[model samples]
Target: MKPIITTERLIIRELQPDDAAGIFRLDSNPAVHEYLGKSPITTIEEAQNAISFIRKQYETNGIGRWAMVLKDTNEFIGWTGLKLINTEEVNGHRNFYDLGYRLVQEHWRKGYGFEAAKACLDYAFSVMKLEKVYANAEKGNTGSNTILQKLQPVHTESFWDEGVETIWFEFQNNKIGS
Candidate 1:
């Protein structure tokens, strides 16, 4: 697989070794990491480690998160793709797929999150033959909830953990490519 997914204004692909600096910039922005439950990464080494880990996920599972690039500028904006997440305790399932995306601060307020995430959802349901995809966002992330609402995912539940509440969303088998 070439690992490239081209959209009208974005390119979704696997992370490359040279992307470490760009990934570092995205990961190191405190504003971007505010709702991410941790501080920004401070080192290129951490970005490199993340790249290796993502690649390993692709190799082992045939699916993983993808780096998103702006088509006009070819600049790394962020990432969006599928991930196997722990849903056993929450949904009574051991292995479940989730759709996720994160963009740098500068890209916020644009439609990039929805664009990239919709593309990933298409890949998951159409290409990967997945029947469902789940997503979660911090309770106060109105932007995220809005984007997910456009997808018509079922609003599962809201739960508080460690002082933060998260809203869960799920898109099931019937709505792909609709």
Candidate 2:
């Protein structure tokens, strides 16, 4: 599949049926799901359904989280991109472009997440021409929060919901990394 965005180590492409196993490997890890307040998925069918939902967003909105594959090995490690978000459906977020990323455990701490995120945000601002992007992380998830903080995202909101507290961050195209 042709990639929408490419970096030195990764290629970001639209989700596909073939990415089911990758998605399963990513979301099925309990450690990965801990900060998100969800449990690991036990079946590949669930991963397929999740991919279908993401693919639909591309059809309806023309943008969605994309598959992040390693260029050297062609491994579908995970996904990272801008997702069109609505406040009603996704609590703590207003209608805005949301920056998100998730990866399988073996790929963690190697800077792939940060590398993919920078490329995705660049695409969102330059190619997609978005004005701003929003993001959130659990207060204790230092890794993700650090990624957002390093982008110099302005603090948006800190809200409590469903017994968990999360902090929202925003990155304006003109002010990113300023």
Candidate 3:
């Protein structure tokens, strides 16, 4: 498939049904699910279901996570892209697009996460013409939170997410000048 975004060492492309195994390999590991408070998928079928759900997001929301493939090895590393989130804030706030990424443990700390994320943010701002994007990390996920820290600060707030405390971070599109 043609790539949606390409980084120095990675290819970001649409997720496909054949990606089920690679996704299962990434999401099924307990280490990967640590920060997100999610359970690892036990089988490929479950991963397929998750992929189907993400594919629907592209059709309905005009955006969704894409597969991240390593350029050197042609390996399916994980996923990264924008997602639409609904907020229950009492002030009439509703939906917004946010950035997110996940990669297998073996690829962690190799700079794949940030490379793909920075590319995604660039695309969202310049090509997609989005004004703002938001991201959040569980309060204790220092690794993920550190990534969010690299961007300019908007505000940090604590909230209960599915009963767990989390920190939300927002970023404005810089477009060309930013």
Candidate 4:
């Protein structure tokens, strides 16, 4: 598949049905979901369902998280991209574009998250012509919080999400990477 965004070591593309195994490997790791506030999946079927839902977002909303693959070995690392948040309000905002990324447990802390996220942020602002993009990380997830900070969002605030303190960041098209 053609990559929607390519980094030095990663290729970001639409999630495919064949990625179910990779998705399962990612979402089934308890350590990965520690700050996501979501339960780990127990079955490949659940991962397939998750892929279907993300694919539907691409059709219904024009964008969704894309699979992150290694450029050298063509391995599915995880997912990274934008999600159009129109169905629910997060931090009192709705109908916005959000940047997100998830990686396999072994891939954590190797800078892939930041690499993929920065590429997606650039895409959202340039190709998509989006005015702004929002991202949130659980307060305790230091790695994620740090990456969001590096993107240099225009504004930030702390809010409660299901009893967990989360930091919300807003990156304006003009202020990104500044």
Candidate 5:
């Protein structure tokens, strides 16, 4: 497997076909899907398709979300990384790159999201040469919003998909470590 970034406790890597089962497990958990605005995945095929799309994003965008795995246990936890949000209103913004992540319920409150996200922000600003990275979380998703606040302050509240209220955060490149 082509690993993208390896942290002390996690290995951020490209999604693979074999990862469908793990992705299914992660996406099927209602608790995990609670804040994501979508229902739990009902089939492994859906996860497989998602993996394929993620692979395509890596090829087409050069920077896409990565599958995060625990290093010591080698278990698939979830994903974290950057993505391009090309919607017109969002596209009009100066910083179109967005940092995102999703972790399994078992991994919640374990600092893995923060650890992996910090690394992703470093890569976005330092390696990818992005000026800023943005992120959003549902209004009541305090855990995700808290993690984002550590990286960047909330710039505004926006509606995602014209419905859910999301708090958007922005991290400028100058703040990233070289």
Candidate 6:
């Protein structure tokens, strides 16, 4: 499949049915879920369902989390991209774009997350012409927090997310160049 965006080390593309196994491997890992509600999916069917849901977002919202693949090996490492959060309010905000990514356990600490995120942000500001984007990380997830910090979001706030304290960041397109 053609990629929506390509970085030096990764390809960002829409999620597909063929990615069910990769999603299963990624979401089924407890380590990968450590910061994401602590609930790992138990079946490939669940993975397929997830793919179906994200795919629908492309049609309805014109954007959604995308599959992140390796450039060297064409491997499905995980997913990364922007998502529209219009259905629910988060940190007193809705109808905004959120940047997110999840990678397999083996791919952790390898900078894939940062690479994919940078590409997505470029797409957000340059192609999407978005004014701002938001991201959040569980307080204990240092790796994710580091990446968000590096992005230099204009605003940061702490909020309770499902009983867990999370740090929310807001990145403005203008602030990036200022």
Task: Report, for all candidates in order, the number of backbone clashes.
Answer: 0, 0, 0, 0, 0, 0
Listed in order, each prediction's TM-score against the native is 0.91, 0.93, 0.91, 0.98, 0.90, 0.97
Could you tell me which 10 consecutive residues in candidate 5 have the lowest summed lDDT?
86-95
Per residue, candidate 1 scores C-alpha lDDT tens digits across 1-178 of 1546888899999988888988998999987887888788999999999999989988887778889998898899998899886534544444788889988888988999998888888888777888888888888888888788888775568876567888888887657332
Q: Name the better of 1 and 4 by TM-score.
A: 4
After superposition, candidate 6 runs with Cα above 4 Å error: none
> How much is the lDDT of residue 20 in candidate 3?
96
Candidate models: Cα lDDT each = 0.83, 0.86, 0.84, 0.94, 0.82, 0.92
Extract clashing residue pairs from model 4: none
Best by TM-score: 4
Q: lDDT tens digits, residues 30-147, model 4?
A: 9999998769999999999999999999999999999999999999999999999999999999999999999998998999999998899889888999999999999999999988
* Model 6 Cα lDDT, one tens digit per residue, 6-124: 98999888899999999999999999999998899999999999999999999999999999999999899999999999999998998999999999989989998888888888899
Mark the 10 consecutive residues where model 6 has the least summed lDDT: 169-178
Give candidate 3's error at residue 76 in angstroms. 0.6
TM-score of 5: 0.90
Q: Which stretches of candidate 2 lie over 4 Å from their true place?
A: 87-93
**How many angstroms is residue 134 displaced in model 2 relative to the true structure, after the best TM-score fit?**
0.2
Q: In candidate 3, where is summed lDDT lowest over 10 consecutive residues?
A: 85-94
Evaluate residue 98 in candidate 4 and report its C-alpha lDDT on the 0 to 100 scale.
91
As for candidate 5, its clashing pairs are none
- Model 2: colliding residue pairs: none
Best by lDDT: 4
